[model samples]
Target: MDAVSERLAEVHGGIARALKDAARTDAAQLVAVSKTFDADAIRPLIAAGQRHFGENRVSEAADKWPALTAETPGIVLHLVGQLQSNKAEAAVRLFDVIHSVDRPSLVTALGKAMVASGRRPDCYIQVNIGAEDQKGGCAIADLPALLAQARDAGLPVIGLMCVPPADVEPAPYFALLAKLARDHALAGLSMGMSSDYPTAVLLGATVVRVGSALFGGRG
Candidate 1:
């Protein structure tokens, strides 16, 4: 097998093991994050049967995905980075799922954009699980209000997404996100990356955003 295919297989194996250990019959969706990489790098994963992919920027996704999606059937694109309020319309048009709905203003923008474009992409409220200043998730304290705003605006808020502080044990953060989702009656938990996805699965992540494990280090 080629390098990408080998890596993909390894990731699938890891996910399977995690699921078995969790004793959960439901499958966790793996969103292969294809942010900086080009289409050439992505096609191999798609050919290897990866349907859900994530991009970081709206413009970059627009630049690449139109042609790629037209050629491949059943591709679900996710915006897994912070979205600009101004680009909501374009983002709404391009992506199938958005994992960074973090604030009231952004929620409002996305809601309006969805109305204008007639496309409602699945949304996950990003939580600042680590309370980091640089990250793009909503503060834990503000989650309820933001969620309420998102729901009122008619955005299809499905779950919660989080990126824990780097270089720390991520299990607690993942567990916390899962708890928050449960508290809000949300079923989806979009957490974990290449480093701690198996732990995340054990803690109850319905969707894991994996990038480097599948694509290798970004250039």
Candidate 2:
């Protein structure tokens, strides 16, 4: 096996172990992020039984989905980055879940795209738990209103998605999302990344998106 494959195996095994130790009833979903990677690089991962992947750029995802899907049937694709309003239509066609619906305009566009395409993909409302000015997420105080609006507008708001503060521990942020999901009666938490996923899992992350650890350093 190649280095990337080995790393993927290690990560997957780690996730499994985390789930076991956490006493989680369901195994954590590992989204092997495939952004900045082409089908050639991802084909081996598919062969190794990886069915879930996340991508950031709409254009790159568009380029990779077809060939990757053809080679590995039933793969789940998630758009996990800030999606532009203009790319809503194409994104509706490509992704099975959208983990970055942060703005009102984007949600409107996604609702329209879903209406046009007849595909209501699962959505996660990105929350700026850290209150970072640079992140693409709704403010904590704004979540209830935004989630209510998104749901009423036909977006299937599954749960909250967040990136924790860079230097602090992730457990608190992950716990915050889990509590919010409970308050809202949601089912998932698309938190964590390559660096802090174990903390996320322990804190009740139903879905974790890991990129560099699975696909290696991206361009």
Candidate 3:
């Protein structure tokens, strides 16, 4: 096996063991962040039973989606980047779940795209828990409005997604997301990455996006 394949095996085993120890029957879903990598790098890992994957760019994901799906049937695709309004159609067609529904305009665009495509996709409301201006998530105060918007648009509100600030500990952020999910009565929590997944898992993260840990550093 290649290095990526080997790393994926190790990571999967670690996640499984972590789940067992945590007594989490779901043990946090691992959406391999396959943003920078391509089919060649991901195929082996998929062949080794790693299915769910995430991507950041609509254009890149559009290119990779079909080939990857053909190579590994039943794989779930997630969009984990800042989704632009213009790319909403492609996002709906390509991703099974969108983890970056942060803005009202974007949500409306997605709803329109779903109407045109005749398919309503699952989604998560991204929360800017860190209050970072440079980020693409909604301010925490705007979540209820956003969630209501998504619900009214016929989209299935899966849960909350966020990228905690660089310096802050992720447990609190993950914990906050869990609380928010409980408050909102949503089922999924898409938080954490390679660096903070353990913390995220501990704090009840249902979905964790890990990239470099599975496929190594991006170029």
Candidate 4:
């Protein structure tokens, strides 16, 4: 096996171990965050039976994934980055899941796009868990209204997502996100990346977005 394949195995092993340790052997799903890498870099993981992958930019994904998906069946593409309202139509057309549904306007745009195209992707409300100015998520106070609007617009809002404050202990934020999901009755928790995913899974992460741990550092 190649280095990437070995890394994939290690990450999967970590996930399985994390789940077992948390008494959740089957609760969480690993989404290989395949943002910057091209098809050649991703082939090993696909050959090793990875089906779920995530991308950051729709334009970049459009350039690479059409050919990749044509070759590999059962590839579930997820949009895991900040999405502009203008890209809603293309995003709706491409991704099977969207983990950044944060605003009422975006909800409206996605709803209209899905209506016109007859495709509805599963959505997760991204909360600005750190309330950082640079991050993209709905303010904590706006979540209830935004979620209601998303549901009203016929969105399949299944979960909550957050990239906590960088370089801090993420456990508190993960716990807070879990509490919020419970309060709102949402099912999935799209938290965790390469580093703190084990903590996230322990706290109730149904979907962990693992990138660097699987693909290594991206340039």
Cα RMSDs of all predictions?
0.7, 1.3, 1.6, 1.0
Put down candidate 2 lDDT per residue, 65-171, tens digits, no spaces: 88778866799999999999999999999999999998789889999999999999999999999899988899989898889889878998888899898988888
Candidate 4 colliding pairs: none
Which number leads on lDDT?
1
| CA lDDT scores, all candidates in order | 0.94, 0.89, 0.86, 0.93
lDDT at 70, model 2: 81
lDDT of 4 by residue, 1-219 (tens): 878779888887887788888887567888999988988999888998899999999999899999999999999999999999999999999999999999888999999999999999999999999999999999999999999999999999999999999899999999999999999999889999999998898888999999999988999
| Best prediction by TM-score | 1
Report the C-alpha lDDT of model 1 over 77-127, residue by residue, as the tens digit.
999999999999999999999999998889999999999999999999999
- Candidate number with the higher lDDT (2 or 4): 4
Instruction: Assess every candidate by TM-score.
Output: 0.98, 0.95, 0.93, 0.97
Q: What is candidate 3's lDDT per residue for 1-219, written digit by digit as tens? A: 777678877766766766776788876788999888878888877877888999999999888779768866799998999999999998998889999999889989999999999867789999998889999899989999999998998887888999999977777788888998999999899987888777777777888899989888889
Q: Which residue pairs come into collision in candidate 3?
A: none
The runs of at least 3 residues in candidate 4 whose Cα sits more than 4 Å from the true structure, single-residue gaps closed, are none
Better of 3 and 4 by lDDT: 4
Order the candidate numbers by lDDT, best to worst: 1, 4, 2, 3
